[model samples]
Target chain A: MKSMLRTETQSKRRWRYVYAIIPSRKEHDFGQIGLDDENVYTIHYREIAAVVSDSSTKTFEVLDYGITHQQALEKIMKEYCVIPMSFGQSTTEGDIKTFLSRNYPKLRIYFTKLVGKTELGLKVTWKIDTTIKEIASSNIKIRAMKHQIEGKPLEKTYRQRLTLGTKVAEELTKREEKIASEIFARLGRISADAKMNKNLSDEMVLNAAFLVDKTKEQDFDTLVNTLEQEYGEKLLMKYVVAPPYNFVNVRIRS
Target chain B: MALIVDDLLRLPVDLGMKVLQAIADDADAMTLKTERAVREQVLKTQMQFERGDLPEEEYRATMSQLRKRLDEVKGV
Candidate 1:
C-alpha cells in the first residue's frame, strides 16, 4: 500500500537522474542508444557524455568495469575536446535534445575547428624534501633560526620549529609558482595554445593542458623531456592528456 | 531464504545502503555511534574552544585526535 502511493507520486512528478558516461570507445555513437533490461538511451553530447540517472534511488550510479575511466575518457576524448560538467548534474533526455538543437549552430562551429586535436595535461611535483633542501640552502635566515632553536625544551621549541616548517612550505610553494610560470611560457612557445590549472599543493606544479596538434605530440613530449632533464633534480612532472570528456580522483586502489 | 528481522531488538548500527553498507555494517565504522556522538566526539571540542572551555593548545591537541579518527573512518 505504501509502495503503490509512492509510485503514484513518482509518476506525477517524474524526473531522471544524470550520469556522466566515460567511454572507452574512440568513436561516438548516435544510434537509438544502448539500453539495459529497462529502456533508456544515453545522450552523447560532443565529448561530454551525459545520461539520465535511475529514478528509484536519488543516487546516480557510476560503473567502473575496471576499464579505467581515465583511459576510456581519453580514448573518446581525442575526438572533440569539450567542457566537462561539474559533479551532480542532472537533466532529461528531451531537455538535453532541446539544448543540443538550440545550440547546434554554435557547436558545429566549435566542433569543426577542434576536429584534429587533443588536450595534454602536465603536472610537476617536487619531492618536498628536495625543494625544502634547495630553499634551506638558499635561506641562511631559516638555517640560523633552525640552529638557534635547538637545545631547548620540547614544549618551548616544538611550536617554534613548526612555524619554521610552515615557512619552508610557503617558500616551496613560491618556487613552484615561479617554475610553473616558466613552463607555461615555454609551452606557449611550442604549442598552438595552452591552459594551466594552477593550484598550490605539494603534489604537482605545472598543472597545465596543451592543445597539441595530432602530429605534434612527439615534439611536445620531446620538449617536455628537455625541460624535465634540466629541472628534474628539484621537480618531477607527469602528463595526462584530456580524454574525450571534460577531464577531471582519490584513494583506494580498488 | 535469508535471515530476516521480524522482532525488534537493540542490535548493531545501521550500515546505510549500497556500497557504504560493507564498511558501515562493520563495528569499526560506527564513526559516531549516534547523533549524540557527533556532538560529543567532534562538535563538543569545537564548541568548547569557542566557549573558552579549552585552552588553545589543549583544544588543538584534542581536535587533531578527532580529525585523525574522522579521516580514518571517512577515508578522506
Candidate 2:
C-alpha cells in the first residue's frame, strides 16, 4: 500500500517472492536447488533465500533476513525474476534436492522457457459500504422491518435488523464470488497458476496469477486494460510482477 | 524417534516420482534409502513442527547442523 522496500547489494543467492505456498510446484524446481538448508532431521526446509519480512524489525536488518514480500512483488518485471510458490510449502533439504534433481532435466527445460519471466498477481476487491448502500436502496427487507418495528419492542426490532445484516453478508459473499470467478475464468489459459485468496476475508472475490512470456507482458496488460475499461469504479485491482520493480506500480484509470 | 508424518508427506504429486526415476537411472546407489523412507523422515519432522512440539527456527538449525556434520564425515 505504501511503497515497496528495496536495496542494492551484491548478494548471489537471490530470493524472490511467490505470493503463497500453494503454487510451489508451478516453477518446476526440477532439482535446480530451491531451499538452501534443512533442519536436523534433514527434512525441514530452511531456505537461504532473500525473502525478508516487511515487518519493521526485518526491514531494518538486511544481513540476516530474506528480502521483503513487498520488495519482491513490486519488482516483478526488471531486477527480481521470481517463481512464486503457492501459499504453504515446506520440506527437508536432502529429499527436496533429490526431488529437484529428479525433476532436474524437466526443470532445467522449464528454466530455459521461463528464465526471464515474472508472474503478476492481481486481485479485485469491493468494500461493503457501496454494496450495503445498494442493498438498502433496492431491497424491501429493510422497509418491511421499519414498518413492522413500529409496534414491536425496540430489542425485537434490533434483532430483526441483525438478521437482515446477516443475510446481506451471505448474499454478498455468493454474488462476489460468482462475479470474481467468472472474470478470472476467462484468463484460464493465460495463467501458469491462479488462486483466489479466501483467507483474508469472505468478501475476497478474485485472486489470480498470470504467467506471461517476457515479450508478451503487454498482452497481459491489454487484458487488464479491457477489464478496467468495463469495471473501473466499484472494483479495485492491485498487481505486481517481480524482479523488476520493488515498488508497487499502482494506478487506477477513470 | 517414533515416526509421525503429516499429509504433505504422502502428496501423490511429489513423492514416488522423484525417487522412482533415480532408481530407474541405474547410476544411483540409493537403493536402501527409497522414496518411502525419505518421505517418512521428512514427514516425521514436519509433524513435529505442526504439533507445536518443534520450533521452525530450531528445526532448521538442527537440520543444517546435521548436513554440516555429514559433509565433514564425507570429507567433501
Candidate 3:
C-alpha cells in the first residue's frame, strides 16, 4: 500500500509532453516511440485529441530532442493529420483537456484546411565562381571594369577593383532575384500556398516551402525534376517532402 | 563603511529585502534572456549543419561550445 501511494504521487507529478494534436475521438497507444523510450498515447476531449507522453522533466535540450520530436510527428502524420506543437511543451493532463475543450472549433478548422495536403521543401544553390564568371562575361559594365583591372598591380587598381566587386555583387543579387521569382512562380501555380524561407548561404539562391494538395504532389515533383534538368550543371536543387513546420505551429497556452 | 551602515540602518528591513529581490529578479531576467539567445544560436547552427553550409568538424565544435555556454547560463 505504501509503494502504491508513492507510485500515485509520482504519477501526479509527471507532466504530459505534447507532440501534436489530431482530430480523433478515439484513444490511441503509439507504443514506446517517444523520446527516452516513453509511451506515446492520445488523450481525447470530444473530437480533438492531443498526442503526448508522460514526461518527468519539463525542459528538453533542442539539440538532443529536436530531431526525435520531428520524427515522432512524421510517424504520427502517416496515420493522421498532425497539428504540430513546438518542442518543450509540457503541461498537466487536466490542462490539455481544458485546452482542447476551449479550442475545439479552431483546431477543427485547422484540420479541415490541412487534410489531404503536405509541405514540400525546395532549395536551389549555384556555384559562386561559375556564376561570377558568367556575370563578368555577359554584363558589359562589369566586363569593362574587369578589363581595366586585369593584370594591374593589386595596390594600383584597388579603387577600380572595389567598384568592380560592388557591380558584381549587384548583378548577383539581381540574377538571384530573377531566378527565385521564376522558380516560385512555376511551383506556386501547383501549390495551395507557398512560403519563401531565408537563404542560409551565399551559394543558396532559393529556400522555399510549398503546401501542395495530395492530388498535385506528383505534378509538383515533375515540375521540380524538369527544373533540375533545365538548370543542368548550373544549379543544384535539393527537394524534400516534409511536415508543415513553416505553415503550422500550434502554441497552447499553459 | 560607517556611512554605508548608517544608510542601511535608515532603510526598513522589508524595503531593503524588496530592493535586493528586485535586483535578483533583474539578474534572473538577464540570465533567461541570454539562455534564450544562446538556444536560438544553437538552432541556427544546427540548421546550417543540416543545410550543408557548415562542415562536420566545425559544426560539432560550435555546438559543443554553444552547449557549454547554455549550461553556464542555466547554472547546470
Candidate of highest DockQ? 3
Clashes of each: 6, 37, 0
Q: Give one digit per residue, the lDDT tens place, for model 1 in A112-181.
A: 5445666676777876545555676588876676566655554676565666666665676688778889
Residue A104 miss distance in model 2 (angstroms): 1.7
Q: In order, what lDDT does every prediction score?
A: 0.51, 0.41, 0.77
Residues A28-129, candidate 2: write the lDDT tens digits: 222211223211111112221222211111112111112232223333223334333321233323434454445445544544545555556666777545
| Model 1: residues with Cα > 4 Å off, grouped in runs | A1-59, A63-75, A78-97, A198-200, A244-254, B1-76
- The regions of model 2 sitting more than 4 angstroms off are A1-64, A68-102, A146-154, A242-254, B1-76
Q: What is the TM-score of each candidate against the true structure?
A: 0.53, 0.45, 0.80
Judged by lDDT, which candidate is best? 3
Q: Order the candidate numbers by lDDT, best to worst.
A: 3, 1, 2
Q: What's the CA error at residue A50 for candidate 2, in Å?
A: 13
User: Reference contacts recovered by each candidate, as fractions?
Assistant: 0.00, 0.00, 0.04
The digit string of per-residue lDDT tens for model 3 on A74-183 reads 78988987887766778888999989988898888888878899877889998665566677668888768666666667688766666766677678789899999999
The TM-score obtained by model 1 is 0.53
Candidate 2 chain B, run of 10 with poorest lDDT: B1-10
